[model samples]
Target chain A: MSAQTVADKVDRTDRLGIQQPRLPRLAPLGIAAGAAVLAVLIGVLGGLGSRIQWGLIAAILFVVGLYVISTVVEGGRQAKDRLATSLVWVAFLLAVVPLASLIWETVSKGIKVTDGYFLTHSMSGVVNVAPGGGVYHALMGTIEQVLIATVIATPIGLLTAVYLVEYGRGALAKAVTFFVDVMTGIPSIVAGLFVLSLWIMILDFGYSGFAGALALAILMMPVVVRSTEEMLKLVPNELREASYALGVPKWKTILKVVLPTSIGGITTGVMLAVARITGETAPVLLLVFGSPAINNNPFDGGQASLPLYIYQQWGAGTSASFDRAWAAALVLIVFVMILNLLARGIARWKAPKTGH
Target chain B: MAKRIDISGLTAYYGDFKAIEDISMAVEPRSVTAFIGPSGCGKSTFLRTINRMHEVIPGARVEGKVMLDDENLYGTGVDPVSVRRVVGMVFQRPNPFPTMSVYENVAAGLKLNGRYKKSELDDVVEKSLRGANLWNEVKDRLNRPGSGLSGGQQQRLCIARAIAVEPQVLLMDEPCSALDPISTLAIEDLIGDLKTRFTIVIVTHNMQQAARVSDRTAFFNLSAVGEPGRLIELDDTDKIFSNPSVQATEDYVSGRFG
Candidate 1:
């Protein structure tokens, strides 16, 4: 029925609307034909001079020809839609061109020095030469420091979230929420400097991986707390009521029913927050004094991480160091990508099955 | 087999604001009583007070004597939890735990308070579902999520959940308001049958429902301008609907004041 109506309307428009028309589609078609003929003539002329620029000129004429034909064959609505669509495609192409170019340039330039030695060796001895360079120590340092940070941050973050969601009542909860909000927007370098001053200047302890972890903890705690708080809030009040109506105590309700219901979302949020802080470089640089060889202890001395390794190698300016830096960057990106995929997978798996 | 409830001089408050004042009533054993009133007239509040569900709302307080089998529920050292265990409630919205299956939803109250053997749980689940008149339709799909059922089934599931712990006094707050006419008739019939075993008190806005399902009816109305709720009459349902004592009850039943 719809198709028949549309066909009848089309017939009516063609028969009745075109009866009083001359060049109903003529002016736009004429202009389009004229431009195409001109583009062909230009191509013929350019064939004698140079054929390369002819491709570029023909592309431009084709676009201009489309604009002319559209304006004539259709009314303002169709013409405007065509114009907007063309412009959108052009804008998309413009964006893709630069992004693709940057990615291509990074991969091509950065892959030259990336090798197995880049993974296994380190910048411990010798000089800034093209032959002796790697990020093995830096990679070890990064992993140990981030693991230490996770240890320091996870309990505090989860506890704070539990308190806020389960027991928080009035002014105290508001105060904690306000502070967490402020902490989320804190500058990374400032957090590093703050932790550095508190431990090194006040307590008079030298730089260690623990200090770097502390700074990263400052950055990570607020994120974990906020995300976990949101996940906890997503748990339905009916679950709490159901538990309470069963004569379960308040603490038990929160622990058994509420936490179990929101566990999936909480895990995803925590992992995402971990991915966020694992790549931090500024605080690590300020608190961790890097070494060429791996130091597993986080509390005693300076350590290196993947971000720090990339920064050091990129700043060193030796060809081999530059290659190691690119390799470290590639590794970090790969780690983040894996974390993202894991987060998505966990979210999908944990989402409650609605129908049984 | 359960005992009766004797409520005297019951008054409810939200913070400092009095909601229902100087109300008193009794629910006999193995009988059904109904509270009927307009919206915000505090019929539901009075119902919640009997089961101590009123305390769930912060700042909600009550001053009253609710004696169930010679024990004063409002007395000091009385755990509201214990009171609620004996006096179960079904809410206006049929809130079966959405995350639980049909069997789990019925078993929630029993499992949460303490541990029960699997054999005991199976017995309780079957009995409760049978008592709510829902066993025949849902017995085969006991593992299905409670939320997947139709609205009427969900309400029956909630009813089954409430009765699973074998509470003596069942307080239903507009249990049939969210149901269809067919479902409402089924619930009304269930209420009539349930009165032979459990003492039941229900709050309902539907006058016809009060007339259809209740043995006794309590008529509630606002006392004065800007004042709290007051009970106008409590009598047999037939007398209350046919020829009430108070002019207020008559006017209300005849759609004058309300």
Candidate 2:
């Protein structure tokens, strides 16, 4: 108690005065007032005559002022980091704002046109100058064609990936890998042309949805194979060893353990591939010739997908058709967005429950 | 019940490079045999060879005989998968299958073999987890992920997983090297209990642990450049610690050259 009393008596109260300099509290207010005065000056000088140019200049000045003020107070490093983060957010908003705005505009404007008759009836009997025709034929054709493409691409892509990752040995797998890399870079138009030449010259087959699907599959396979292969590789080798140690057959191990572990990623990748080929207009235009009415058969006639429907309508150059085209484009975008969301949801839902 | 594992002139190679050559030792029934050496001395490699797990590596191969009872493990047309079924391995780090629940991890091997009825699976999972001394702590959270368990418990879950397949021989490669002192003690206690039913072969860098848990110890070394690992000595644990037959073994045990 005596030592504590003596220590308390000797304690230096003046030594603990603030060491770091206090920040200027009036700085932000001063900067804001300066910005407001400059904006008013620019508005008065320009009035309503050159408002857009003046607004642009004012925006630039506002940004520069903010940068100067922040850096002056916060020091260079933190201010730069903050600026970088702000710029990233700005870029993200720039991309998202337009997309959101376009979607909102489309949904509001086209809801009236997006009815059952719009889905069921084609533009076969309706005149192009009028606004009665719907995208029913295009929607049906798109579904049947995309479904056929998925069926064709999914198995071959999955198997190729399995062989590359699991059983790939020596130079053969290397060769396959190299070729797949090359194929991945092939242009969409090139793919369409290749398919057109192959069917017309080699196979002598006429234009049909099946041929279009085959073309899309050519584009789709490399994507699925590459994504699925990477996903499969992510399944740890320890898991395979664990299965082997259990006396489980290799195939069963792949089916039960390996596939289940990677199924989430595989499904997501597959969905992405589906989304990619679903909007492919060049391949369908080249491979499948157009038919006016509903073509339920994929192997028989040229079926118009949503993209082709929009394309054909826009080419027709009538205001009514142009409206239909914009509306159809909106619908297609919504469909793709829904498919992406569905894929992501399914992946998360079915993902093997690994604990914390 | 424990079982004997005999190796006669066993040699292992990776491609053309011999990793371990002409090494022979026997793991006695119901006893622990420790393999101790410095890094890259092929102690773990030799342990892997005994269970035919060496072949899991792309180019690794073995010659000569590793016999369990009267069957030669290296005989022609022998499937390594069947060999692995009878001889389970625990790795240096705990890998309790991050995607599997605690109960599922214990029953992983059993479920892989066949579709078990729920009652049978529940019993087997419980019994194996109990055998590994992890049942009590995890019983309430059996549905939780195996990875959610503490490091020591995760290692124990891995042990439970290995035993769930009813393996006759258990090979542990520095199993407790990644654990803390208390966890190491827990594993050591579990090892002592496990030896009653399975032939135990362990590879360790820790001499104190070798002395503590092993009945017999084999010391390995690789001195000259470009030479395969050679066994320095193999003897009863008591003699190996107190009075070793080889100078290298004495030096290693007494904290000399590794």
Name the candidate that leads on DockQ. 2
Worst 10 residues of 2 chain B by lDDT: B110-119
lDDT of 1 by residue, B69-128 (tens): 899999999998888878888878777775578998899888877768877999999999
Worst 10 residues of 1 chain A by lDDT: A19-28
Q: What is the DockQ of candidate 1?
A: 0.38
Q: Report the CAPRI category for model 2.
A: medium
lDDT of 1 at A66: 58
Off by over 4 Å in 2: A1-71, A101-112, A200-204, B115-120, B224-227
Alpha-carbon lDDT, every model: 0.82, 0.84
Candidate 1 residue-wise lDDT, A1-356, digit = tens? 69999998887788656533233545544554565567678878656465435534544664566565566766556667656665565567557867787667667776776678877876777454455667777877877777788888888998899999888878999999999999999988999999989999899998999999899988989998999999889988766765666666777777777776777788788788878888898998899977767687888888878898778777879777777777777777666668778878877765654664
Please give each candidate's TM-score. Answer: 0.79, 0.87
